[model samples]
Target chain A: MTHRVAVRPSGVELEVLDGEDVFTAAGRLGYRWPTVCGGKGTCRTCFVQVEEGAENCSPVGPLEREGIEALRRPVDGLTRLACRLRVEGPVTVTKRGVRRRVQE
Target chain B: MMDETSEPATARCPGPSVQDYLDQDSRPVPPALRYERNDYLGSEDIDTARFTSREWAEREMRQVWRRVWQFACLESEIPEVGDHEVYEIGDDSLIVVRTAPDEIRAYVNVCLHRGRKLRTGGGNVSEFRCSFHGFTWNLDGTMQTPPCAWDFPHVTPEKFALPEAQVATWRGFVFINMDPYAESFDSYRGTFDDYYIWPLENRYKSLHIAKVLPCNWKVAQDAFIESFHVIATHPQMLTWLADANSQYDVMADQPNWNRMINIQGAPSPHVADSVTEEDVLETFYDSRSFYSAAQGRDLVMQEGDELPAIPPGGTARQVLAARMREQLAATSQQDFSQTPDTELLDAINYLLFPNFNPWGGAKSNIIYRFRPNGLDPDSCTAEIIFMSSPKQPGETPPPAKIRWVPEDTLFADIPELGVLGPVFDQDCENLPYVQQGLKAMRKPGITLANYQESRIRHFNQTLDQWMSR
Candidate 1:
C-alpha cells in the first residue's frame, strides 16, 4: 500500500500509504511542499511533475484546472495536481524551482 | 500677419469646418460613468471618531474589506518544505505554508481546541500542533495526532480538520480570501493583465522589507494612489517626483483601479505646452527624488560622462527625461507604458483593489498589505514587504535593519513605518483618536473634498455600494 514520491534537483523521496495526498505524506515525513489554499488545489503552489504513474493520480479538479490555466500550461494529458492526486501504487513527483527572480 | 478683427475679413473664417464640426459632434461620449465628486468621505470623517471604535471598525471591515481579495504573501516566502509565513488582515490570521516540495497551503491561524492561535510568527514545521492540548494536524490540514485518542470515542480526523482559506497566486504574489463564495481572484483583478501579467511573472525577488503601520488600513492605502497628497503630506516625495502640472490617470474604474502617472516632461520638444524644456531637463536629472542623494551620486555622471541611472535610458539625464515622458504619456492616455519591451523596470505602481499595493521599480519591488489588528476597528496592521532580485541565488539579502531617526525620519525611512515607523506612527498614531471621535459624535457623518482626494471618495462610495448590495 506504500507509494513513492520523488522530488527533483534535490531528489528527495518519501513513501506514503494509499489514499494519502502527496502534500500530507511529505509533510508527515518532515519534508516541505509549498501549498496555499490549504491543499484545496486553488493555489498552484502544489504543482509537481508527474514523472511516473500519472494514471495513478486523480483527474484534475476545478481549482487545479483554474491554476493550470493561470500558469498558461496545458492541462489535457500528463500533469496532475499533487493536492488532488490520491496515492495509487508507485508514483514520482518532481518539484521545479520558480522561474522568476523574485520569490513571493 | 494682419490686424486682429479686420484681418479675419480677408483671412479664412477661422471657424470649425463642417467636417470638423461633424467629427467633434460624432465623437463618442467617452463612457459616461460619472463618479460623484462629493459622494466620498474625507480625512475629517476618518479623524479620531470613526477609526477608533471597534464596532464601527468591524462594520467597515464587513462592508468594505471582507468581500475584497487581499495580498497574503509571495510564493518565494515558502519556497521550500515547511517554510511558512503568517498574515493577519482585519481580525483574521492565515498561515501560508510550504507543505510539500511543490505545494503551498493556507489555514486559519486558530487551533480547533479552545480557539487558541496555533502558530505565532512563521517557520519550518512538519505539523501544526495546538499547544493547549497537543492536538496536531499535518500540513494538508488533516488531523494526525490527538492526546489520549482512546479516551475519545468515534472521534475521527475528518471531524476536526483545520479550517482553510481560499488562496491564489498571480505573478509570484499570493492572495487569500475568507469568504468561500467570493469571486475568483482573476475576476477581482479586473484589467491588471494589460500591465502586470508578463513583467510580474518574469521578475525575480531581490529584496524583502517588512514593516507594520498603526493607522487604519485605508489611510495607509490611500497614501499610495494619488499624487495630490505628495505635495503636502510627503514633502520629500514631492521634491523628488511631483510637480503642480503633474497629470492623473484612472487606469481601471470598474472597481476603482485608479492610478496617477505623474511626470514632469512634455511628449516631444516640438509639442507646444507650458512646461518648459528646462523643467523637463531638471525632471530628468533629479535622481535624488527617487534614490537617496548618496545613491544617486554614484549613478549621476558629470556633464558629458556616461552612466546608468536607476531605471533605463542611457545617462541620468536621459533616464529622467524618458521616465517623465513615459509617465506623462501614460497619465494622459490612462494606460501604462512605463515598462519597456525587454527590461527590468515595467510597472511603477500596481494598486490592487482593497488592501494590496505593489510599487514596482528597477531597484526594488515594495508590496503593502494592510489588515485590521484585532476585533478593534480603530487600529489596523500594515505589513510592508520590500523585495529585490538577488544578483545570484546564494547572494546575501539586503541589510535587514533600516535606520530611522525620530525627528528626521521621512515616511520612507521608518522601518516600522509600514509596521511601526513614523509613517505608521503618523497614521496609527491618529486612528485610536479618530475611533474615539466616531463613538462620541452626535451627528450622522462628515463630508469629503471633491477633487484633491477623489480616490478616497470613490473608496467610500464603493464601500457603501457593496454594503448595500
Candidate 2:
C-alpha cells in the first residue's frame, strides 16, 4: 500500500511506497528534499515533524533515536527523520524546505 | 550527552555519525571518544600576515614557541647518555640529550664563546665541544673548560654552563619548554592521554620521512587536522572513509587539543547512496596493500587469502576490523579480542597545540610533526613517522633514520612511504598556490567552515591566546 505524505506549508505530496522512506519517495515524485548526506540519515537537515498521524510512521529505530537525543531536536516527541521514516497511511508533516524539483 | 539544549554552538548536529558506530561497538568507549563540545569561536577573517609576514614569524618565536611545550624528539632517539639531537624552531635551536639512564635534558644549542651553534645535527658524543672555539661543556651542561682559562676569567662553570630548558617525557616523547616558568608538561598535556589505547611507548619508529613544503607551518599543519579535504584532496578514500560525517570535536576541558575520528569501511557521506559494501571492501584491501608490504607483513591480504564476504546486513568495517583483530591476536603477544572496532579500524587522530599529531593506535601507526623550516615563515617541514607495534612482541625495533625528501621530490617517489606518498603529493599540489593566494587575495582574512574546519580555527584561537601576551 502506498502512503501519502503531505509536507506542510509547501504541501508537496509524496507517494511513499512500501520500504521507501519519504526522502526516497520525494526524489521519485520529483520533489527536492534538502539533505547533505543524501539518504544516509547522517545529516540532520532532512528531519521533519509528524503533524498528524504519528502512529502511522514506523517505530523510531535506534540510530534515529540516537540522532534525536544527540541533536536534542523536537520540542515535542513527534519528530521523525524523513530518510528513515516509513508510513502505512496518509500523514501530515511539517518541514520548511521541501519543494518541487525544477526541471533542467 | 553534549547538553546541546543549552549549548547553541553545537546546534549543528549529524546523525548516523561516528557516535552511531561507537554505540554499536562492543567495547565501552571513553569520554574522550564520545566527547563533543565546540567553544563557539566567532566568525572572523584571519589576517594573512599570520602566514606571510617576517615580523609575524619573529613574534611567534618569541611568544608562542618559547611559551609552549615542544616535542623535541623521541626518548628512544637518544637512548644512551651523551646521545643528542638538535631541534630548531624559528630562530632558536636546542640540544636534546640523554644525560643518564633515567634522565633527559635540553639546553641552548648555542656556544657561550661567540654564539656559534654547538651541534649541527644528531650524533652520539661524550661532551659538547664548540666547533668555533675550544670551549666545552659536559653532558650535564656544566662548563668543562675554556682553552685559555687563565685568559678568560669570565668563563666560570656556573655562568658558562649552557642554559637548560625544562624537560619532560610522556609515553616515548621527550618534550621541552624554553620558558623556565611555563606550566608543567603534565598539565600542559591535560587529559590528552585518555584517547590513546595502544600506548605509544610500546611502539618504535619504523619509518621517518620529512618533506619541506612551500607554505607556513600552520598551513601545512591544518591540512592533516580535518577530513574535510578528503572528498576533494583524497577522492579515493571516499570509498571506505566517511568524511563529512567524521566526528570533529574540541573538548571544553582541553582546548589545547582537538580531535577528528574518521570511520573507515563505510562510504563517505558525500557518496553514500552510490557505493556498496562490496565496493568498500575491495577499496579497503587496495588501500592497505602498500603499508602491509612496507611492514613485510601482508596481514590485510596475505598471498592467496580470498576477499572476505560481507554478510547481508553486515558492514565492511566490521568484517575488516575482525580480520585485523584475529591477525594481531595470533601474531603478537597483546590481547586484541576485546579491542573496539573503532580503535582497530578508524582514523582516530588528535592534534596537540602547536604541532604534534598522534594519528591513532593499532594498525594505523602514524604521527606527524610540523615546524617552520628554521627562520623562514613561508616554508615548513612536515614529518611523517610510522611508529609501529613490535614485530616480535617485546622487541623495540631500531629507530628509523630520518630521510629528508628533497623539496622537488613527490612523496610518491619515496619507497618507504608506500601508499601515503601519493596522498601527501596531492596535498602538496595545493599548498604553494594556497600560500600565494593568501598573499595576493583581496580578502584580508581566511574564512573557515564552522564545523568541519573548526580545528584549524581552534588552533588559530589558541595561537592568538599565546601571542596575545
Candidate 3:
C-alpha cells in the first residue's frame, strides 16, 4: 500500500509506503521533513495539512499534544504532526510555507 | 507526579541564594565594570576577514569565550545510547555522547595516551577506544582498558579517566563550561528566564545546519544582536520582512544575558514597547479584507459600514504588517502588562551571551550556535536549527529537506532564507571581511559610535569585564 504526499509552494509530490511515518515517507519520496527529536515526535517541525485521507492516518499521542500546545499551533483536525502520523492509506499533505527546509 | 528517580538531585538544587552571589559586595564581577580595554572593536567592525585569521582568534578564546557557557548541541542530537556528536569551540574540541539510557556525558576530544583526537566524527559505541593504540575509554569518560594492562603493571585504568567538563541542560540545549570554577548555568542565565518562555524540553530538533567561516566568533554573534544593519546589509530582507529604525530596547540590568525588543515602525530598529489591543482587531480585519479583495472573494463587512477602505500605502506587505501590528495590539490589551503576549508578537529575537540566539515569530522559531574554530582567533563555525510546532498528535514529523540556494541566487527565490540559513549567510558574507579589516588596522583598535550600535559596545565591554576577571 502507498500514499501520495504533495508539498505546496514547491509543488513536489512523492509516493510513500503505507505504515511509514509521514516524515520518513516524505524522505523516501526525496522530500525532507523537519524532525528535531530524530523522529521521536519531539521538535514538532513536521506539521503538514492533510488535504485528503485524514481518517487513514494514525491517531495523535500525548507527546504530539504537548508539542502542539507548546508551539501554540492552531489546534484543528486538519493539521497533523508528520513525525507522529503513520500512513494507513492514500493521503495528500501540504507543507507550510514559513517552515524551514529540513536540514540533512 | 514528578518522577523522583529520573530527576537528578541537583535538578532541585536551590539556585545560588541572593546573599551568596547577588549581595552588593559578593556579586560576581559586574559585566559593565570588568574589562576596560580600549583595544576592543565595536559591532560595526564585524565582517568575514576577522574570522579567517588563526592567531588573533586564539587570543579571544583565551580571554573571552573560555569564561562563557557555550551550548554544545541539542540533547536529542544523541538520543540513543552510544549516540555522539563532536563540538569544537575555539581551539578546544569536546564530544557529547549518550553513554547509557537517560545518561549523557561530555569529554575533551583528545585521547589519554598520546593526546590524539579520540573519534573522527559522531557515532554509537559501547566504548571509545583510540584506534592508534587501542586505548579504551567508557562512554562516561572512564578509562576502561589499556592495550596491555599487565605490561604497565603500575598504571591504573581508574586513575587515567578522561577529563570531564562542567555540563548542564536546559530546555534540551546542552551547555558546557571549560573553567572548573565557572558559575552554574542557571546563574549564567539569570533574570533571562522570562525571555525563554518556549517549552524547549518539549520541543525536538527539526534540522541542524552548520557552516565553517573565516571570521571571529564575536563577529558572527554580533550580527544577530541588532537589526541596525538590516537596511544596508540586507536590503531585500528589510523590504519584505522588517522595518529598519524600529524602536529598540535592551535589558542591560541583567547579568550574563541580554533581552532586546524591537517594535515595528520605531526609529531605533532595535527595541519596542508592548503592543496594544486596537492593533490586533485592526490587523485581523485588514488581513481578511485585503486577502478577500485580492482573491476577489465577497467582502463580509458590518451592515452599516462599507468594508473599511484599504489604508494608503497598503501594499500586500503593509497589509501583512498591519495584521501583525493589530495582533500585538490586541494581545497588549490583555491584563498581562508585564509580559508581551508572545502569541501575537510578529517577531521576537533573544540573544544569549557568549554565543546563542533564538528567534521566534508568528511563523517559526530558530536556534543558532556559534563557536570559534578550534582555538583559532580568526575563524569560527555556526550551527543553525529551524523549528516549528506539530499540528496534531500521531501526525508524522516534517521532512528534513533543505533547498540549498547558492550565494549568487536572489533571496526572494529561496523560501527558507527568511526563516534561518540565508539570513545567517547574509551576516556571514560580511564577517570574514570585517575580521580581515580589523587585522589590517595600523593602530589595530576601533572606536564604537554610541548612537548607531551601542549593543556592540555593550557586548565588548561585557566581554572585557568577564575576560579580565
Give the residue spans of candidate 1 off by over 4 A: A1-104, B1-50, B62-66, B210-214, B234-253, B264-347, B360-363, B389-452
Best TM-score among the predictions, by candidate number: 2
Give the DockQ of candidate 3.
0.02
TM-score of chain B of 3: 0.69
Task: Give the range where candidate 1 chain B is weakest over 10 consecutive residues by summed lDDT.
Answer: B29-38
TM-score of decoy 2: 0.77
Residue range B1-469, candidate 1, lDDT tens digits: 2224331221111332212222222122112111111222323442433445566677766765666677777776677787788977667778998888777778988878678888776666667766566567788899864667897666688898988878888777788877778889989877656554333544454434343444565655665555554344433333223333332334215564543333322222123244344444454444333333221111233466443334443222335534433443432232324433112221245566776666543334556666566665544555555554334334434333322233333455632223123434444444445445555777666444334455555555565566666
At residue A77, give the lDDT of candidate 3.
Answer: 49
TM-scores for the candidates:
0.58, 0.77, 0.59
Number of colliding residue pairs in model 2: 1
Q: TM-score of chain B, candidate 2?
A: 0.94
lDDT of 3 by residue, B1-469 (tens): 2234332212211322212211222113233222111221223433333345555466667766666787877776777897788877656788888877777778898887888888766656556666566677777788865766777777687778888778888877788887888889888887666555665554445555566666767777777777667776765443232334322234455535553433322212221133223343344343333221211111223446543344554333233344444433342232212222222233456667777777644323567777676766666666666654434323335324323334354433433333233455577778878777777766545644433355565566666577556
How many angstroms is the interface RMSD of candidate 1?
10.7
**Candidate 2: where is the Cα deviation over 4 Å?**
A1-104, B1-8, B11-15, B296-299
Q: Is the docking of candidate 3 incorrect, acceptable, medium or high quality?
A: incorrect
